[model samples]
Target: MKFVGIFIILILVFSCSSEENSLEQYANHPVKFAKQKIDNPDNDFSIFIPKNWEWKAPYKENGNDILGLFANSKSNKNGFKSIILVKKYKSSQNSKDLKSEFEYLSKQIRNHSQIEEIVDFGSTDIFNQESYFFHTKSKSDTNGDSEILNFLINGNIEGIYYNLTLSTPQTTDFNTDMAVLVQSLKTFEILK
Candidate 1:
């Protein structure tokens, strides 16, 4: 009986230690991104949303600048949320070149007062076409100490420029969400 009791205690202690080790490993391991294809209801273009992100129906904008918008369902619409906005421009110029499109996007954001930092994330392929990535922080009035992660990307298709943006507060622990967003952006496709 004494031997059995000692063995059971040992087993319990080892099992608890193993669980702690697993948790440590999980915290140290890099996150893998997830991607899911989403169809565009307004046009032939299709985009990808990260795991757990859902489609948001396009609503009437206060202005004519927005073409579409999407967001992660878990986001708070009233608060700082993770979302993608599709901007449409009517112009005769072809904006398909990824580098130029990125420059244009950078230029547009240069004057925003709320933007705290802008980092050039370099170029990444999306929809088999080159896409430029940028990381930025925007001030959140609600979350005083928290910074917002803004993921911006742009590409031109058929002489039109489309800008997609994703933003969420950093306090939410959005590392995996950001990775998923990047992966989803990589899968973006627009039908010509």
Candidate 2:
């Protein structure tokens, strides 16, 4: 059973290449709805939210820009998500460094969430750019809603930071879209 769970994590990540973005397995994912919204008043930020979710602004004292997303799987009560945010310091230079930072941050976030790191699949985005994928789960913390997180250098040249999480409402709620939220990311465009 333990090994099988690990296998699932591997499949969720590992899209074959670091520079390829494929929705191949995304649809197989039970994500229902998703959206991209401006999380900050300054308009310097945005994030994708999954369906049947609730959004909460981050506290001022938080070290990094943060937002909360709670998912609602109308059918599966165990279908939910939470997103713990950290900063993404990425531009053009040293792309590898940005990827490393994301990976390290994901590790720290997973530990804070009390979840064990199961899979860390390396990935890339639309333009054939290298990125990272991570999945963490806290089965004992929540009954059905397990935390599935993907920390990566975004698919866009904008270098957006993505932190996708999934869990149940009993444990926590992100209050945002789960499926369409990713789609929202695809539609993201950079501004001068």
Best by TM-score: 1
For model 2, what is the error of residue 4's alpha carbon versus the real structure, in angstroms, after optimal superposition? 27
Compare the candidates by lDDT and give the number of the best one.
1
Q: Model 1: per-residue lDDT, tens digit, 99-138?
A: 6655665676667777776644556544345555556666
Tens-digit lDDT track of model 2 for 1-73: 9999999888767755333223334423344454545453434455554444454444233333333233333
TM-score of each: 0.60, 0.48
Candidate 1 TM-score to native = 0.60
Q: Candidate 2: worst 10 consecutive residues by lDDT?
A: 169-178
Alpha-carbon runs more than 4 Å astray in model 1: 1-36, 51-54, 59-66, 76-79, 91-101, 142-158
Q: Candidate 1: lDDT of 7?
A: 100
Relative to the true structure, how large is the alpha-carbon lDDT of every model?
A: 0.54, 0.44
Pairs of colliding residues, candidate 1 = none
